[model samples]
Target: MKLVNIHTLIFILLFIIIGLNTAQAQVWSLQQCIDTAQVHNKNLQMNRNNISIGEQKEKEAKANLIPKITVNADYKYFSNLPYQLMPLSTFNPTAPVGQYKEAQFGVPHNINANLQLSMSLYNPQVYGAIQTTKIASELTELQYLKTEEQIFFEISNLYYNAQILHNQLAFIDSNLINAERLLKNMQLLNEQLLAKGTDVSKVKLQIAQLTNQKESISSKYEQVLNALKFAMGVSIEQKTQIDPNIQFKRANEYTSSTILDIRIIKTQNRLLSSELSTLNKSRFFPSLNIIGIYGTTGFGYDKQPNDFLKFFPIGFAGIQLSYPLFNGTVTQRKINQKQFELQNSELQFGLLTEQNNMQVENAKLQRMVAKKAVETTTEQIELAKTIYEQTVLQQKQGTASLTDVLLADNALREAQQTYLSAVIDYLKADLELKKLTGNISTTK
Candidate 1:
C-alpha cells in the first residue's frame, strides 16, 4: 500500500512537470505574433479577396470589348396544311379511304454554327468602364494596404498590453516577497517581547492582504495572457511569456506634422479625383473596336444532294455606330451625381487631414508631459521608500505607532506602483506616436 501511494505521487509530479514544459514551448515573439495574426485574421483575408475581385472586374470589362460567337440547333415538324404552290388535285394519293390531305412534310432539322463578333464600335460607357475599373482595382489595392496598417496597429497595442501585465505581475511578486519577509521579522520581534500582539497581528494581516493581492494579480495575468493568445491567433491551450524588457527607442525622426500625417488621405483623394475625371470624359467620345464573324447555316427544308452535302458558309462584316442623343436627362443627372460625390469626398478628406493633425499634436504633447511625470514619479518612489524605512525604525524605538508605519509602507507601495505604471504609459504612448507617423514596422 505504501509503494502504491508513492508511485501515484510520483506520477502526478511528473505530469505537472511535463505540462509546464509543454506550455513554455509555445512562447511567441512579437514579430511572430504579428505574422501569425496576419495569416489568420478573417477580416484581412476578406480585404485581400476584394483585391482579387477588383482584378476580375477589370478583366471582365476588357473582355467585353472582345467579339463573341455561338452555335444553335433547331428541329421542327409539320402536319396537314393547305399548299399554295401545289396543283389543286395534289392531295395525298396514298391517304386512307376517308382521309384527305392537302400537304404533308417530314421532321426537319436546322443547324446553324456561327462565329459572330460584336465589338464596341461606338460606346462611351464601355470605354469609361475600363478606365474606371482600373481605378477601382487601384482603390482595392489601397484598401489592402489600409487593412495591413490597421492590423499592425492592433498587434502593436496588444503586444504592449501583454508586456504591461507582465510588469504588473512582477511588481506584485516583489511586494509579496517583501510582505513575507516582514511577517517573519514581526514573528521574531514578538518572541523577544519587543512588539505587542497587535503589532504581530497587523503584520500578519498585511501579509495576508498581500497574498490575496498576489492571487488576484495572478488571475488577471492569466486573463491577459488569454487575450494575448487570441491576438496572436494561438489556441487557448497554449501558455506563453512576453519579454517586458523590450523598450521603445526614442528617435529624432521627422515629425508627424511634417509628413506621414496626411499621405494616406491624400492617396484616397487622388484616387477619387481619378474616378471623377473618368466620369467626366465618358460623355465626349465613343469607344472603338473591330468585330469579325465566320460561320455556317443549314435550312434543312430540302433533301436535295446539293443542300445536304454542302456546308453553307456565310460571312459578313460591319461597323456599329451609336450616339447617346438624350435620355430624360440621364447624362445630366449622372454628371450631377458624380460632381456631388466628388464634393463629398473632398469634404471627407479635409476632415480626415484635420483629425490627423490634431492627433499628431496631442501625441506630441502627451509624450512630453508623460516623460516629466515618469521622472517625478521615480523620485517620489525613492523618497517614499526612505520615509517608510525611517518610520519602521522609529516604531521599533516606541516613538512611532503601528498606524504610522503602516501608512508609510502603503505610501511607498503606492509610489512604486505609480512609477511602474507611468513608465508603461510613457513607453506605450511613444510607440503609438511612431505608429501614427507610419513607422510602426520600421523597427525590426
Candidate 2:
C-alpha cells in the first residue's frame, strides 16, 4: 500500500511539471504573432485579391484595341419569285417611248457566309481606361498596406495590455507575500500579550483582499490574452502567452514621414485626375477603326432539267472614322461633374495632410509627458516600499501602531498601482507616436 501511494504522488508531480513546460513552450514573440496573422488574416487576403483583379481589368482595357474576328452565315428560300419593271424598248430600238414590262430578278434559293474583322486604330476611351486601371492597381496595393499597418497596430496594443496585466498580477502576489509575513508576526506578538487580536485580524483582512485582487487580475489577464489571440488570427481556445517582459525606451524627437494614409490619398487624387483627363479626351478626339469582310454567296435551284448551283466570292475592307457631332450635351455634363470631383479630391488631400500633422505633434507631446510620469512613479514606488518596510519593523519593536502599519501597506499598494499605470501610459503613447511617424514595424 505504501509503495502504491508513493508511485501515485510521483505521477501527479510529474504531470504538473510537464504541464508547466508545455505552457512555457507556447510563448510567442511579437514578430511571431504578427507573421501568423499576416498569413491567415482574411482582410489581407481580400486586398491581395483586389490587386489581382485590378491587373486583370488593366489587361482587359488594353484588349479592346486587339482585332476582333467573327463569322456570319445565312440561308433563305422563297416560295415564289417577284416581278420587276422593264422597258418595252428592250426588243425594238424605236418602240413606243415610256413603255415598260414586269420581270423576275433572282433565284428562289440563296445562301451567304462571311468572315468580318475589326480593329481599333485610335480610341481615346480605350487608351484612357488602360491608364485608369493602372492607377487603380497602385491604389489597391496601397490599401493592402494600410490594412497591414492597422493590424500591426492592433496586435501591438493587445500585447501591451496583456503585459501590463501580467505585471499587475505580479504586484498583487508580492503584496500577498508581505501580508502573510505580517500576519505571522502579529500572531506571535499576540501569543506573548504584546499585540491585540484585532491587529492580527487586520493583517488577515489585508491578505484576503490581496488574494481577491490577485484573482480578479488573473481573470482580466486571461481575457486580454484571449483578445490577443483573436487579433493574431488564431483559435480563441489556443493556449499562448506573450513575452512577459515589457521595456520602455525613450525616443528622440522626430517628425513623421509619408505614412500609408498620405500615400493612399495621393493615389486617390491621381485616379480622380485621370478620370477627368479621360473625359476631356473622349469629348475632343474622334475614334478611328479599320473593318474588313470576306465571304461567298451561293444560289441553288432544284428543277427537273434546269437544276443549277452557283457561288460567287465577295471581299471588301474599309477605314471608319466616327466623331460625336451632338448628343444633347451629355459628354459636356459628365466632364463638368468629373472636374468637380477632381477639385474635391484636392481639398481632401489637403485636409488629410494637415490632420496627420496635427496628430503627430500631439502624440509626441503625450509620449513625453508619459515618460516623465514613469520616472516619477518609479521613484515613488521605491520610497513607498522603504516606508512600508520601516513601519513593519517599528510595529514589531513596539514603536508603531497597527493603524500606522496598515496605512503604510495601503500607500505601498497605491504606489505599485501608480507605477504600473504610468508604465502603461508611456507604452500606449509611444505606440501611438510610432504609428504616426510610420516607424512601427516588426523590429521596433
Q: Please, what is the TM-score per model?
A: 0.78, 0.84
User: Candidate 2 on 52-134: residue-level lDDT in tens?
Assistant: 99999999999999999999999989788879888889866788989988888788899999999999999999999999999
Please list the C-alpha lDDT of all candidates, in the order they appear: 0.70, 0.87
Error of 1 at 352 (Å): 1.5
Global Cα RMSD, each model: 7.6, 4.8
- Worst 10 contiguous positions by lDDT, candidate 2: 435-444
What lDDT score is found at residue 257 in candidate 1?
37
lDDT of 1: 0.70
As for candidate 2, its clashing pairs are none
